[model samples]
Target chain A: MLTLAQQLWIGLTNGMVFALIALGYTMVYGILELINFAHGDLFMLASFLALTLVGLLGLATASGPVVVVGLLGVVLACAIFAALINRTVDRVVYRPLRNAPKLAPLVSAIGVSFVFQNLGLFWGGLPLDVMGGGLAAAAPKSFPDLIPSTNLLGDGAAFRITAKDLVVIGSSLCVMVALWLFVTRSRLGKAMRATAQNPLAARLMGIDVDRVISATFLIGGALAGFAAVIYGLYVNTIKFQDGYQNGLYAFTAAVLGGIGNIPGAVVGGLVIGIVRALSDQYIGAQWQQAVVFGMLIALLVFRPQGLLGANVREKV
Target chain B: MLRVEQARAGYGAVEVLRGISLTVDEGEIVTLIGANGAGKTTTLHTLSGLVQLTGGRITFLGENIAGVPAHELVRRGLVHAPEGRKIFSRLTVLENLEMGAYTRRDPDGIARDLARVFELFPILAERRRQAGGTLSGGEQQMLAVGRAMMARPRLLLLDEPSLGLAPLIVARIFEVIRELSKSGVTILLVEQNARMALRLAHRGYVMETGAILLADAASALLENETVRAAYLGE
Candidate 1:
């Protein structure tokens, strides 16, 4: 008997999470034309990093300004750590295979995904308070609810909005907007777009194409780090295996919107979120996954270029 | 000034340029004229660093630059307007021009070059907001030439600028090339149209297969019996 507004609010908050991850997927695909299957695992590892930072700083129960500063510090550290890891992975795994057959890098990406997942498993085993004192390596760990859950619209509203929800949605919006401006207005952004269109032509223009691609990975990874922090704060619990599911969802979102289109990923994520919420409410909980994927297939069959993808064929 | 001595290069297992040697003095239009598959395009590609030189040397402005990357070559004012008008299709004409000045950091110089490019091709200025791919073939060629001009190139390598255009468009393109040479930019012109190329060039080289068969003054090549018979189609 939930109202439509309640469903929409729930969908929006969840969609914001998917959108953040989806942006990473789309950005990398736009630049490299590779799926970057390891992105989800990168996000998962980032969350683990955030948890470790929370414990190391002992800021779980801190309040007010201290909590704000600690959270900011965690976000900064995770962003840098993820960006570096992404850049290194590009240099070590992807760059060498840049001229190989397209399928080679894709296979390498899948292998990298497995490596990241295993790393997450090992990271979860470290003795830490935030990870429940590392009780079991494979167990899901609870993230401290550093964000207050107080209702922002007072206690009397028919549909409530929590402060945590505001933080998640507001921050996701800010990141997306900043990314949009960076890609559209800046000189480096223009270089990235040019590189994507034609690498040889870009090089002839004196653009360092490899540098542009590396910058893409760095920005994508940093965004994933930001998402990791928000995801941990909102979801309250995370597992080493979480990346697979989150990544699949984000990848699906990117495909649904148009794989190389940025705005399309965001819209696709929101749509998936709303559909998941509505289906979970109206249909059986077990059928929600089936419904979401079914919709994707059906939409894809009709709009093969994706919802916002250009009709032009992808250049080799 | 640019010089290539005994240069050898090609794709895997297929040698396209063998012991090719040529030179272009400062402010000279040096044309490389040959039929299709005669290694004309490959020579330009090697000069731009798109193709690796398996053997020999390239010296530009007193520095050896045989193995420099294409991007680095451009930074040294060795700009190439490629054979095909490979403009960034998705970008607007203005953005494509902006990309041409990517290596330059001087705002005033960039601005001045941009204005000059627009003046050279007023049509490009008119279609500044249009996507590069949306332009007509003639317009795309103009944009391509204009894009190279934005780089403020000291030695501009143009590959087949008249490859597939109407007779009138080809005439217009050649006129621009003449104007560019008048502006004191060193030019290396590659063209299948031997008559037009030799007419425009101060010096001309006739390439057959992978080697230069003849190198002389443009007027001498134009009047030579073999050049007239094989290339000029007279």
Candidate 2:
């Protein structure tokens, strides 16, 4: 037995990533009332962009904070990329269907996902980056274990936590908090919520609701781009096919967190992450996927409104 | 201050307000009374640009506002507080009022207008920070009217203000309307409560089907026999 503390630590560290990706899914869904199915693929594509950039820049040759700065630069680049891709998706796929049949945008989202995946495959080919000499072969690379463990909490009890784990947790918390505040505090945020509630009423209030929806896509894309940086560092690999599975999982995280609830995404992501880790540790790696999805099914069966979703009574 | 000429409009295929023409002189409280399906609400929606006018012209304050976007029409001082309250439920009463002056640039004047609305409905002043959805039905009606007043419109379009209020609340709302009319804010009131409406209206127009059936002074319509039998129950 690996001990409860060890499992708890592992679960928490992994949970941060889910929380980040899940936030993107929930935010986009809240504003548009349509899932951005291509969002995860967008994150995957962003990581690939970072890998390509790292290869071109020979970032591994640098030392100390330079490597970190290079990593940040890649993140920034991908943030811009995600924002652009998201904007294009909105303009091309969702905006035209704003007043059309609701299913049109949803189906278009799935089509966009496939199209994005194919574009990635076309660029990087079918081979997973890990397959060809792993990720180190893509560029001169070294995994920067920034934090040396300390025994501050009574020997091993101290956080045994590395700087990278701290980075992931801190960054995810920051992004989540910023997004929550944006939706609740700012004028544009209020407009977005108003539009979500009733677009016709929002328009009468002089809110350019179309503009708010576009901004929503832009914000969702930027956060996903940020998550890409964290994901690349944690996974240390990239592939064209990675997007579909990871994107679906993150979207599942969002649905689990109560599709339209903002904070629910964070809770959902964490729960999914811990459950996956536990299942992997005790139930064996092969059964991990089955275990995680089983929890989802059970949760759905008991509570279809989701963990934090509102039970709105729509008049027939 | 408001003019509609030969207005032809309707849902996609079926025509409702066919060739309707009417005028509201500056500072007059004009009321439109109609039976169910009499095109009263359609007329209001048409005037506010909610229903697109197919073959007509609307000039407000001497500007061709026939086909201006709905939001822009509001900035031009023709504010429509629609039939339903339509308050942004999640927003607080104060925030909803603030949204009323969304297109205004004069912050000070907007503030004054907000203060005036709160004065007009002190209950709203007490519940300024409360979520609009939490208010009683009567309070929500006041919030809707307050929100419209936040626009400080030269002309106001009120659609069925007494639709779903208690008799007492309905009486209070009419009194407020009378006060508003005295204060020089032109109103185009539409209502199914013909008795109370004409009692408060300076002049009333009765619509049957999609066309005007009768128009006369409020006192005349109040005593009109067919009007008494069909509406006032006198």
Q: Which lDDT tens digits does candidate 1 get at residues A4-106?
A: 7788888889998888888889888887789999999999999999999987888887777899999999999999899989999999999999989989999
Any runs in candidate 2 off by more than 4 Å, and if so which?
A1-6, A126-159, A311-316
lDDT of 2 by residue, B91-188 (tens): 78998888777767798998899888888899999999998888988998999888888778888989899988999988888888888888889999
Number of the top-ranking candidate, with DockQ as the measure: 1
- lDDT by residue (tens digit), candidate 2, A195-309: 7665666666667767888888888888878887787676665667677777766777777888867778788888777887788877898997788788788878998778888
lDDT of candidate 1 at residue A162, scale 0 to 100: 97
lDDT string, candidate 1, B99-198, tens digits: 9999999999999988988887898999999998889888999999989988889999999999889999899889989998998999999998899999
Give Cα-based local distance difference scores for all models: 0.90, 0.78
